[model samples]
Target chain A: MKELRWGLLAAGTIAAEFAAGVDESKHGVLEAVAARSGDRAAEFASRFEVPKCYGSYEDLLADPDVDAVYISTPHPLHGAWAIRAAEAGKHILCEKPLTVSVSEAEKVIEAARANDVFLMEAFMYRLHPQIRRLAELISSGAIGEVRAVDVAFSYNFATPRLTDPALGGGGIFDVGCYCTSLARLVSQAATGQDVVEPEEVLGMARLDENGVDEVAFGLLRLPGGVLAQLACGFQLTQDDHIRVYGSQGQLYVPKPAWIHEMRKPKTSQIILTPEGGEPEVIEVEATQGLFAREADHVAAHLADRQAPELTWAETLANLRTLERWRAAVAR
Target chain B: MKELRWGLLAAGTIAAEFAAGVDESKHGVLEAVAARSGDRAAEFASRFEVPKCYGSYEDLLADPDVDAVYISTPHPLHGAWAIRAAEAGKHILCEKPLTVSVSEAEKVIEAARANDVFLMEAFMYRLHPQIRRLAELISSGAIGEVRAVDVAFSYNFATPRLTDPALGGGGIFDVGCYCTSLARLVSQAATGQDVVEPEEVLGMARLDENGVDEVAFGLLRLPGGVLAQLACGFQLTQDDHIRVYGSQGQLYVPKPAWIHEMRKPKTSQIILTPEGGEPEVIEVEATQGLFAREADHVAAHLADRQAPELTWAETLANLRTLERWRAAVAR
Candidate 1:
């Protein structure tokens, strides 16, 4: 079996984390890294034990040894790098939210289609098995018909890195996107339809001095009359969890939002407390068991020339919702 | 001191609970009861050991022994009964939500002011020691500068009463209003503002079969970059809780929403969880507990020709928010 060769477009924290995820994946290998400076790229490459390093994203994408490229850059650079990687005919695993704006996300989609490259948004939590188990439970009507979904992903990001707007920082994009995505994912799974965008949006955002949204909150209306209340902020501390309620009982996944360490990973659990029952923690062997499984699924899909488990259509819908939310808050 | 002569208009669950709350109070008494039928009224009066019973709302307001009337009827009747009670020179203690519509709430406010009666929304939760404690902690900068507030009040009201729009029932109005009101209360307390309203409104709601909101969720933006995410629903089950986050620490009041059982009333606990610190639960005893405190405040205000602890101005601001939320969902 040929290992999927990975290339990273940035050598920052996110890029390093993703490279680590790929490195730890049984079916994938982190082969190359790129940064703005040759010295920085070489440093990142040496630290991660990658073989190749490039001074720029274009140079990394040109490497024939790279079968896939992960665009892990700041907000303004995501769309451009993703389009370039697509044009280079590399399967792209771009970090979420895919771009700074919906139009930019659309352009990335167009570029991927034009280049006939496999493209997927790197919402790693979706690939995690606990969420899949939740989806399965919800689809099977474990909670009967789902009535509402609530999610929050907030953390105190007073670190100057987040305080700066140029870094594509602030709460909404940094952490709020998780709550937004989780809410949509749960609502879609519950209703068995694409998330229906709210007819109107009412938002309250707290802004920092830089005019970036420090804390952003949103509500989404789904078809079949299900409401989703979502809160995300870099300025607050949240449990990084999601809850879905149905006619029968409610299922809660506490701290379900996580980016596992490449090493020393452990199984996560989903706590199910039916109305009249005590809480039962179902240990989810998601990291060691499921990441490899997800990688295998991606590899099989690539080999078979089929789309992965999550379709581009679903990804587009998710991005559209996030865009709508951002627009609502921007106003 | 004279007893607070009280009358309740409705013998439903809330009225029964509230009657018990009044009887348990050290300085109040339930003097009258009213229901749609004379038999039900008489039954409730006898059960609660009240002195008077009336077949109709007008008959109860005509009772000279009743100094104040608590309007505990269905949403559609709140405005009419409150207005009539005010005209009859009776102070009013309405339910959590002042009235069904913004205009109706306005009418209640006008009548209360015009008739010089102490009228206050029966948001008994507001008088909770825990809520007051939370306000105090936030004011004292225990959480540093307050930045975000999140609250949810949801339960599976999928059955008959909540799904009926004709009953003025739905998630948003029935309980979602609590989420909104809680968010507003937290925001006001944190910002040190007498009133707080979101600058931009964005909401998404799931409509029930009867076209009333089954689940409604929204965001509120306050001055100084404060953001609030709120959810209230009849379709989903969630803990009735509120969380406030600031720069230094976080304040959480677990189960703040429905702590209104008049008998087994539990005090809301304030848990301050700072970064890298163990959570400490702050137990606070109010000078007067919820229903009783509000009752005493109203009685004192009426007796001394002073304003109640909570003012109609706040009620009007809250109504404006409700109107905006309704309009956003309507769109």
Candidate 2:
């Protein structure tokens, strides 16, 4: 069994979660932890029992023992750091909204390809078993032809990274990308395509005092007339359930937007209700943490450089869609 | 105690439910049944044990003993019959989407006012105790500042009045009106107003072959930046849950759009989830059918000539909002 040595870049909340989850990974080990703040990096390293700690991301990327880097920096920093990590000959698992714009994401992908490094966007929820089950149900026509998907991923958190435009913070970038990705994934599964792009995207937002979206709504009309509606926010709390409406039934997935893989592992549910029939609750009991599963998935596909389930094309497309939605809100 | 004499008009499925509900009403009785089809009228009258049966609407309107008429005809016929009913000195309980057009609904109200007859739109769900509690909760700010209201009222039933544009069928009129009205109501309750019209209404639809919207989505930007998103369809089945997303919490109401007032009633829940808090379920156990409660509400307010809960002005505004949504779908 090949063990993937993981380097944590930016000792933030998500990085800590990933570090904790990687501790339980079957083929991944936390090798180094780095951040702009040495105190945070040392604290994270000491807490996670990592052998190496660095005050800068470059040092972590340059470490010979580190095979892959998990980039958890704030939005604007992800693109540059991922590019640097790839140039350093390290595989990269970057946090989502892959980059602030399509060009940045494209550049990141281009760099990864040039360096021949494994690259995967960190959408941990997509790697969850529940999402796979949902896709299977959709493909099996259990919900009939998918007609509409409604998703909400929002909270009242006014985190600095989510409220400042310069940092690439907003509802669309911070959380709405989850909605866009899942919606496109549903369309792909329903149509039996690897991925599907929305034919039209419409969006609206309520901007905060800082000129970033505090709350936003977007509509995606996919090929074959599937409409996916997304609502995300940085200033308000919402029921973060994902619903798929179909010709014959409806499927409900609960709190799916941001599942920290290491949350003590609990059983989740996907509720399916056929038209004029009783509800059938499909339970998903996972044996591994979400980040652990995601890390293992990336490790298994490291040789291929891209995970089959969430390919580079899909990640870049999702970033483009999310940015399009954000720009459309202003228009 | 004053007893209200009810005349059944059009003898449709809704009319049948209304008649059965009036049987359990404290202050109303079904006095006559009328339909274009004499057989339906006769059979309805016999089944409900009404003393009078009329083959034509005019005959039933001429029955001097009938104090009120429950107009349950299809969308296109509501205005004309309500006007005639008012002229014949009967209080009017017209079915939803009061008329296909705003002008028609206005005329119906005008006639009712001119004849000094009580008039109300039969939005039975609004008259339900559960709705009252929901309004109270909003007014009490139990969920903090209301930020968004998301509603879906859809089923895969393609009945004539829901699929045929000639009869004023479509998603907006057949079912989406409920979404608009409830969304508006949530706004009003949050803002502490009698009724608050949306500042902006944006809509999109997937039309079926009959030139009617089979599925539709609408966005209502109400006063104070509250957004109400509605998804309604005739060609699909949705979760049909009403969610009120707020600054501090979210509330969920199930199957709220269309409640058959006369069905075997069960306890319904209103799930309130405060941010970072466990969900608290509020149960509503009604002693009367939905129609029965609505009839009693109307009977109590007959002296006022308009039901306070669903005023004539609110009804007219809801129709206008629904039409605007439908029209925007095309533009």
Best by lDDT: 2
**Model 2 residue B286 lDDT?**
76
Candidate 2 residue lDDT tens string, A230-319? 898887677677989888888988757265335557688899999889999999888888888888998999999999888999997887
Off by over 4 Å in 2: A255-260, A263-267, A285-287, B255-267, B285-287
Off by over 4 Å in 1: A86-89, A101-117, A158-167, A191-203, A209-211, A260-263, A287-298, A304-307, B158-166, B257-261, B265-267, B286-289, B305-307
Q: After superposition, how far is residue A50 of candidate 2 from its true place, in Å?
A: 2.2
lDDT of 1 by residue, B1-331 (tens): 6788999989998888788878777767998899999999999999989988988888888989898888888877888888999999998888856887878888888888789887887777666666767777877789888787777787765756677777677777677666667777777777788777777666677764557776677667766456777777766667777888888878888767355434555544778998658899987655544566666666766754334336777777776887787667664
Q: Against the hidden reference, what TM-scores do the models get?
A: 0.90, 0.93
Q: Report the Cα lDDT for residue A151, model 1.
A: 76
- The two-chain DockQ for each candidate, comma-separated, is 0.64, 0.53
For residues A251-329, write the lDDT of model 1, one tens digit per residue.
8887673543233356777777676557778777754533344445566567433244456766677767776777666
| Tens digit of per-residue lDDT, candidate 2, span B170-260 | 8888889889989998998899999778888887788877678888888888976788889988877776778898887889897562553
How high is the lDDT of residue A136 in model 1? 80
Against the true structure, candidate 2 reaches a TM-score of 0.93
Q: Say what the RMSD of model 1 is.
A: 3.1
